[model samples]
Target: MMHRVAGAPLAFAALRSQLEVPGDFAPAVRAEAAQSAQTVELPPEDATDVPFVTIDPAGSRDLDQALHIAASGDGHLVSYAIADVAAFVRPGGEIDSEAHRRGETLYFPDTRVPLHPPELSEGAASLLPNQVRPAVLWRIELSGDGSVRSVDVRRAKVRSTAQLDYDGVQAGLDRGTLPDPIAALPDVGRARLALARKRHAINLALPEQSVTGDGAGGWVLALRTTLPVEQYNAEISLLTGMCAAQVMLDGGIGILRTVPPPDKGAVQSLRRAARALGISWPDGAPAGDVLDSVDRSDPRHVAFIEHAVALLRGSGYTPFNGAPPSQPLHSGIAAPYAHVTAPLRRLVDRYGSEICLALRAGIAVPDWVRVALPELPEEMQKADHLAHEVDRAVVDATEAWLLRDRVGDVFPAVVIDADERAGTVVLDSPAVRARCAGADLPVGERIQVRLVTADVDQREVRFERADSSQL
Candidate 1:
């Protein structure tokens, strides 16, 4: 049930301390940030010919990428420019060592510890609104069939025409008055939508959850999914990143983000669950195929998606100096992938961009980059976990705070997951996922429940079935 808790702070003091960013890094980092801000040269302030716009959450200062799209001889050409973190952080320098130690930017509910200091990350390096900045750019051509025809990567100076947020772009698309550069969104969106549907045809469609701040020291948990435009924009980034990973892998060098494919046992378990829920499966068909036939609106489907999410567990950073992992495919994107789009926030992107830069130049990869490459996977893994842990701790605490006042409220909810003993239910009225107990869940069943208790300090929401059947 949705209820509000007032007067409680959303941010947790202990988690913030645990996620404590080494704001007091070596003196070299400060000097480098200051030097970086001063010596950096921006491109012509008047190079406004390209209709590039920065798309990010509203109030996002550490913008990492800017994009522009245009028609190119019966195909579409997209130019993406990412902040060039490599250009500034010298090899093995203080900032480099510190960033290597941290791996990535850490985000929390109330604050963020940038991988690079604001003077760089959110300031000079960011492709901020109306600012000309140095960038490593990727230009890609896609045929009508959504296949890549060619790719170009280089260093360039560019300026953003405007800053746009996701919902604004979605609203513009819905209104049919999108700006010219983004008018292609709907077309590309449809193509990407088809691509996702195809993947679903062969894979599970998982329901992922993202937590949002409620402005009053609490959180509103939202069931996030690949919105049409979100998926469309992501495809462009993914294609480019995949191309970069391919080029690197083919060259016998570079780090790739990988997650092992799901096991047959899990697939079988999902199949049994599907049969229990009355969903049809083709003879000897894969779990992915069965998922495609299910109705997402049904509570059973939500449960299936949550279970499917387990298939993507244990994703990590993988580095290689020629021989790729035994498995190169990223099951989520259904392609091998690398991090190349957000140099401003990710240390590995700086190295990936450098590799792409060198590959484009037809030069041997720089000794500095090659030497530093071996250590990146671990550093990046630590950073990734730290960032995620901070975000998770904050959101969990905030959700607990928000529900603290609604102990007796009841709301409609659907079962989204079940184990041998307990399960989870997602409240339908508002954006919240809560824990359900007792043996009555039945995995995919829908039922009403009262908020038995909400403990902000404990960071949990306990629910009971509204029906007297529990009694």
Candidate 2:
């Protein structure tokens, strides 16, 4: 059954206060924004001829990327324009220091703590439609078989023709009514996916749960499924990041988003869980392919994804000064990658993009950028930890709010993971995942569980095995 909460403040506000998230920008940061500075020396070359458009979630104001793809000699040409935040914020200035402190934007159901003040991140530096803006343009050329042939990055002035949300783009794709630039996406996106599989990229297609106001003074939790075009559009960003990593690696200096390859023991444990769940792993199949074969909507598949998280642990930012780091690969993407996208939201991307631009332009990297690289990994790592906790807390609080009134009700659930002390289970009705304390819980088997406790303030939900035959 669907659940609703009314006449109460969303727990996210309270949670944010508990976590000490800065609700407003510091006075210095705000005062600095009034005196906006421009840093680009050379005149930005005009690229407004391209019918570039922004694709993001509905109502997303702080847009980051815009693109136009076309047919090249054999494969395709992708002209991706990223917001030129570096051009707007002076290095080592008040805004720069504030952004470095924030690291990245933290999102929640009701509010967002932006990395930069709205006057810049959502205004001057933002790539909104019909507004001419400076951007870091990446003109990437791919071969006939989705192999990258060439890449060029430079400062340019561009104007977006349209600001499109993902839903609108998906609708256009479905009706076969998209313009040439948008229409050409499936061809390149499919090609890129093929290349990713060839390299064994593990792209988990997990459904995200989002809570929204239902317009009747209440909240509704919605599961947003990943769409084909969304995944394909992401591939373009991945391709650019891989190219950025290649440039930095050859230049012998940059921070890489690194993760070690999955441990043999972790993979073996997942294999055991799959067998017990009655799922087959084809003999000699790569991990990515085996993961792709399962249906994400199945409860057992969700369990499998949870188990696979163990293999993808130890993700971190590794900065190298003299030589490339020894562990340089982001095992999740099956490539050595640096974050050069989403500079408006992430602090590291601005530095990464500047390094790529300097290397491509044959100019010396700025002293400020060089000095900040080594210190970024630590601050970025801490911000990442906070972001993860905030996201989890918001979800937990929302789940607790939805189930607060259903304490004694029994619902069907599947045990996802188990131990002697406690086990994790997913309830069918409210679509909430929580813990269930019990004995002899069968993994991957449906059972009736009676809600034992639902504490809204504590952000907890607990259950125990029940006699389902009574239902």
**In order, what lDDT does every prediction score?**
0.74, 0.85
Whole-model alpha-carbon lDDT for candidate 2 = 0.85
Q: What are the models' TM-scores?
A: 0.90, 0.96
TM-score top scorer: 2
Model 2: per-residue Cα lDDT over 1-471, one tens digit each: 345665647767778889877678888887776567343343359898899988998888888899899999988999999998887788888889888888899998676899999888888788999988889999999998889999999989899999998888888989998767777788888999988888887767777766767778777776668888898799899999999999999887888999999989998998998897888898887777778788887878877877777878899998876788889999989999999989999999999998999988888888888999889999899889888888888878888888888898898998888877678888776878889988767787788898988898888989988874646
Q: In candidate 2, which residue pairs clash? A: none
The deviation in Å at residue 458 for candidate 1 is 3.0
Worst 10 residues of 2 by lDDT: 35-44
For all predictions, the C-alpha RMSD in Å is 3.0, 1.8
Question: Which residue runs of candidate 2 sit more than 4 Å off their true CA positions?
Answer: 1-3, 37-42, 468-470
